[model samples]
Target chain A: MHLSTSIWVWIAAFFTLAIFSFLYKDNPFYRFAESVFVGSSAAFAFLNLWFFDVKPKLWDPIAKGNILYVIIPLILSILMLTRFIPKIKWLSRWAIAFTVGMGAGLGITGMIQGYLVPQLKGTFLPLWVPGNLATTVNNWLLVFGTIFTITYFYFSKPIKGKFGVAAKIGIIFIMVAFGASFGYTIMARVSLLIGRVYFLLHTWLGMV
Target chain B: MKREIPLLITFIAGFLIVVALFIPHPPFNKIEETFNSWYIIVAGFTFILGIDSLILHNWEKIRRRSEGWPFALTVILSFFITLIWGIVSGVRTGHIFSTNSTFRNYFYLYIYVPLQATMFAILSFFIASAAYRAFRARTLNATLLLLTASIVMLGRVPLGNVALIPVISIAVLMLLWVLVDELKYVTSPTQRLIYIGIAVVAVVAAFPITKFLYHNLSPVTDWIMNVPQMAAKRGLFIGLALGGIAVSLRIILGIEQSYMS
Candidate 1:
């Protein structure tokens, strides 16, 4: 008989069982599978970088006589590789410096506009309109929530009195949001479990 | 000096990029882009480090004659084999590599695809075990947990009520209440005042609070992601990014040489 789709699926079902065997206890099978995964990923990542990202972005350009463009990067790349050398590990410092410098620069720039300012702007929507009752309530609640949450994180200052109480309530709102998120994640994971079980029963055992 | 210089560059470059965003100039944007390309180039070298570490780690284990020596040997073997295959498949030189080779396809299909699927499949039993523990009806909180779990569980299946009746009813009731009271009020006259204020501020800042702002999803789904849900996510990402920067800086500057040792 020709190997049909179902037969291919059966092959997958066998491997799935092999991997899932770890849940019972670690064994040679699990180790074998885990080794396969780690080995494959390492190989994949290394090859993908050279073939997809590096060769085009650097090596190809250099080969085409964009030699000047290649100089700084080639120097940096060599410095980075110096970490592998025993006596000259310190030479890698210059390369590391450039990378860390650039990353921090990018992050700080992105955070203010992408995160901080927008979030702060989002908090103070105009609740003073002519026709919106729920909008008014939501605006007020959000405003209160923002003020309180800000204070909750700002530990440098002491909280006291009425505002302090509002901040405390704000903390509760944050916690409830976190709990809800946790519940949502659990649901997602459990759904995946159900999917696997369904596959095992219907496809492997042909019990469905 | 090495550590200090890098930290200084980081501080300056970070400040410059932030300033560049507000500058509305082309050159600053170009510089930022250039810096970004360099960052990508630097990131490529990290793979070399990974391969080196993998080789050294497995080599040490094998030299020590560890229990999993054969496994380590297999990994080293695969590493070199792929390295060789990828080098040979360098036909498209100026772009991301593609292979028309049957060997590459077979490797991906037989090796990579199953490993990924199997990895996902393994989570099933772990989830079942976790659910069995987490869904216990010991207290009020546990009851709520059980309720939500059952509802979500039943919602997926054909006979949902049979699988998760109690939770589904609670979920339906909660959804109905929100739709009727909160949603209705949100559209009413008093809430109109709030929307005008939000609109004006959002427009002025050039950041509209349009329903489904970032993630192109259904309105209901978008609302869930944008509102309170985004807070923890933003915080988590910031924390992770900052931590990575700090660790990386220390390593690069040679202040944190633990990895090397």
Candidate 2:
């Protein structure tokens, strides 16, 4: 008979307990769970690659008689294997260079499209609204905050007069945002920990 | 011949693929997709390399009878066992770890969900600890932080306001006070000047800014995030991408001996 779904559930709960035990104290259970995680993840990654990528994308295509199909990948893959070779180890540079070059080119293009044009455009928001002090005040604050913060990042010249003051205020806003991000990140990580605990308690020990 | 030709091919092929984006051809797209698939295969191999390094590092520690030897052994053993199990299952026709096998059920139930949840769960205690420190309210900034944090925390839970209106109102008042008249007292004159100048400069620099129509609590906050914030993020992102490229190039080219070493 196929492994029942319940077995999987039970196994999960056990690992959860294993992880949660860490909060109490770093112990054997946590170590066991962490180890299993690494091993399983590695094994799964390899299997999935063999199943999905190397098999269909490379191996299958090559076998189908596209003699030219195998050349580059085969060479690259073999070159990659050269790490095992003691003397001719430098051959792996080609693969690295190719990957890096492409990645850099993609990043350069993305940076322009993603950041520069959009930010400069935001500074021009309409601040004056008829009989809407709250909206007007909010817009003014945003405009002020964005400018100063950007200025704070730019250290080309000494900030003087009004610009310096605004930049300080802008720093506060940025800090607040960063704090929120940190809080949220902590929440996410903690939640994961709790999940492991809950799994251990409910599934492994059967104690709610 | 093998080495020089490959390097030349690397430079030429890399440039061509990048320039290929400007070309509106189906083959260009296909080549991009092929590269993506290759990335997955390479990533898998990288994972193996990582595990190997981990094992090697841990093995040395264990052999020397250092601290945490048990943990190291546990890691190495688990890795080998899992590999053996998966391989055995994959080789067997109807085995559970076979392709699209039921092992995924085990992975999902026993591993992924629990790990994810546990990671999130650990935050509760940390939040409580942070709240203790940040909510002390010794200073005006501290007070503001406490108020916003309390509001947000309460907002996260259902019936927060209904159950704790007094607390919520107190926090809201603190926020309002800071935002209004209190801001002048707290913000230094130099800072104020910077704020005004920035406001003026931002207005002047508005052209060529990306406009995003998205929902948010504050329009001003959204605008800042979408525009200048996005720009800053993009700059960092570009740097990160370039770094990734450099690292990848180092590895693929075998110029980087750290991994192999």
Candidate 3:
């Protein structure tokens, strides 16, 4: 029956309950909690970026008189700040350009290697195995299912007759997959609820 | 000049990175890491833009004395309190504000984490209500979706599996029968050819495929996930990859000017 004595724990419990109150209806408590959450989160992110990344990586070296390499990045960063100035907002585009270009480049390559290659490889399975009959059947199903599903998405040719049947099978697979995802999502949300409930009961009310 | 320069930058950057993937040389291999470092610094500066917007918005609300202006005040105060505490305290162990400063930690632990988690947790109620409305069986597709969702939900939980296994097994068997029956009445020659190919392969395998079907909730769920779910996901992944490459090409070629705007 021992309750949480820490004042921080009490504050946390209050905020948790304040947020949960939204389920009933929005109120001042919920709004206040929401504001505090947004403000603190932004502040936290800002501080972390400043302390961990900008300070150590950019600022410290320059401050310590190692100024040669960091100059370009420093200039780029200042250009990014020009977005606030309406007159020179166009200058900010250079910074945006660099970021977006790099992002597009990196993303394209990474997706090819990480996602496309692996998924394509996954589709390539041995249909018939000597001993493992179940696995073999599952592999066959996987191959056919992949082909049919891909055909469902093919927009070049009109789907009719046999293609229609395959597409129908594809839709069924997609729906069932979506249902599985939804079920998993529900599980995640319920876990969070259980955590909050545990906090209320064990931490706030001292009833385990 | 404004547009062309950015487009050129995009082309050069994208091309270099793409080339870097194949080339294992010093400067080429290091291009991503170098660009990432630069990007981080630039990204850090952009947060200032965000903070500026937040401040301006809240200040405007306060000036106008809008509805719930006090809440706006709360936002501003919390922002400054958190920002000042972090800046004053310093990140590392010891500084002007002592190493054991609980102020920043208190706000982060008590306010931030709980609010975030509770916000997400609140979605559960909404989802349940939404599911209640959306799960109505109006058509064959809707009925199938509802049935699939019900089975998945029931099978996911520990205790539900014991009660729901037989139901899920029956459902799976029914679904398999439907699939088989659907395959039987294909009128299209191409479809018949594909079916015949599969049948030929199955006959050559000479294995009792039905033995693979498990009469349990977990196994049924596994079957759904491994077979249909994975295939659908792979289809999506391939489609997305193609779409992404196209978009990236457009960006590199200066056709996608939306980002510049």
Q: What TM-score does each model's chain B reach against the true chain B?
A: 0.60, 0.54, 0.74
lDDT of 2 by residue, A1-208 (tens): 2323476676666666677678789888887777766656666666765665566667777789774755666566666656556598677655654554455445444444444445446556679978998667656665765656566665466777777786666556554544344445555666665555555556565667
Lowest lDDT sum, 10 consecutive residues, model 1 chain A, at A1-10
A1-208, model 3: which lDDT tens digit per residue? Answer: 8888988899899899899888788899999999998777767767877776678878899999988879878888778878888899998888888888887888889888888888888889998988999989888878888777777886567778887888888887777777777777887888888888988898777989
Tell me chain A's TM-score in each of the predictions: 0.84, 0.77, 0.93
TM-score of predicted model 2?
A: 0.69
DockQ (CA atoms), all models? 0.30, 0.26, 0.57
The CAPRI-style docking tier of model 2 reads acceptable
| lDDT scores of the candidates, listed in order | 0.61, 0.57, 0.77
Error of 2 at A187 (Å): 4.2
Greater-DockQ candidate between 1 and 2? 1
Between 1 and 3, whose DockQ is larger? 3
| Cα displacement (Å) at residue B115, model 3 | 0.8
Q: What C-alpha lDDT, on a 0 to 100 scale, does residue A170 get in candidate 3?
A: 81
Candidate 3, B106-159: lDDT as tens digits: 765676778998998888888889887766656676766676666677666676
- Candidate 2 local lDDT, residue B3: 56
Least accurate stretch of 10 residues (summed lDDT) in model 3 chain A? A150-159
Which residue ranges in model 3 land beyond 4 Å of their true spot? B91-104, B165-215
Please provide, for model 1 over B144-221, each residue's C-alpha lDDT reduced to its tens digit, 9 standing for 90 to 100. Answer: 444433433333345443433343345445544543455445866767666555545544443222222222323333
When 2 and 3 are scored with TM-score, the better candidate is 3
